[model samples]
Target: MSNSSNVTKQFSAFYLENRLYGIEVGRVQEVVRSMLMTPIPLAPDYVCGLINLRGQVATAIGLRQLFGFHSEIPQDLINIVCKVDGMLISFQVDEIGDVIEVSESEFEPTPQTISEDIRKFMQGVYKVSNSLMSAIDVDNIIKFLNNKLK
Candidate 1:
């Protein structure tokens, strides 16, 4: 079983504040620099707004606000566009990192020390060289947001 779980997968890493997080590279559509966002009135606080990505309207989400962080979003943001349930959603992150290939053996369950809000959306944690990278579950995130919107 352990040997079966040792398959390697690539993840696109990004930063929220100082914390590192990652999503499966296959789920990521593209990463774009800061772009003009059109605010959606009556939307959840975490929903930053909408961005036109190559003529497609993508819903932009404020990753910090979604994680219950009270700090203001930085002026320069990097948006990681991911396809969840056939829909494209953009996650605004503080900084974009590299695409790291990690083996399943290096993945561990999320620790209890992590805050409740963040823990809910994480699939697991990967033991990187210098720091732990929390794996973000895009499906769960989309489900949660859909529930909130309903």
Candidate 2:
């Protein structure tokens, strides 16, 4: 019998505050270079601004802020466009990493040692070589954003 734990999943990885993070490749629409953004007035601090993506406006979310990182956003950024709840959203990242394939056997639950701010949105983590790549929970992210807006 084939072991499910041997199955591998692909993730589109990125960096924020020097930590590695990944989102399921299936939900990722595209990764793009930084583009001009129009700041939204009175929007939550995490909602950095809006981007013009091929004439479609996408909300640009500063992952650092969303994750409660108290650091200034870098001038150079990468946009990881993802399809969440049928809406196109752009996540502003500090740097972009390659697509990673990790086996299910490497997965582990988020540790209690992690801070609540960052841990809340983590689906889990995958042991990668010498490091752990935290998995971002896209659904929780959208739900949190929705709640913030309401």
Q: Give lDDT per model, in order.
A: 0.92, 0.92
User: Which segments of candidate 1 are over 4 A away from where they belong?
Assistant: none
lDDT, residue 65, candidate 1: 94
Model 1 lDDT per residue over 52-132, tens place: 988889999998999999887799999999977667799999999999989888999999999989999999999999889
Clashing pairs in 2: none
Over 4 Å off in model 2, which ranges?
none
Error of 1 at 17 (Å): 0.9
**How many residue pairs clash per model?**
0, 0
Q: What lDDT tens digits, residue by residue, belong to model 2 across residues 1-150?
A: 999897999999999988999999998999999999999999999998889989888889888998889887898999999977678899889999999999999999999998999898999999998999999998888898999988
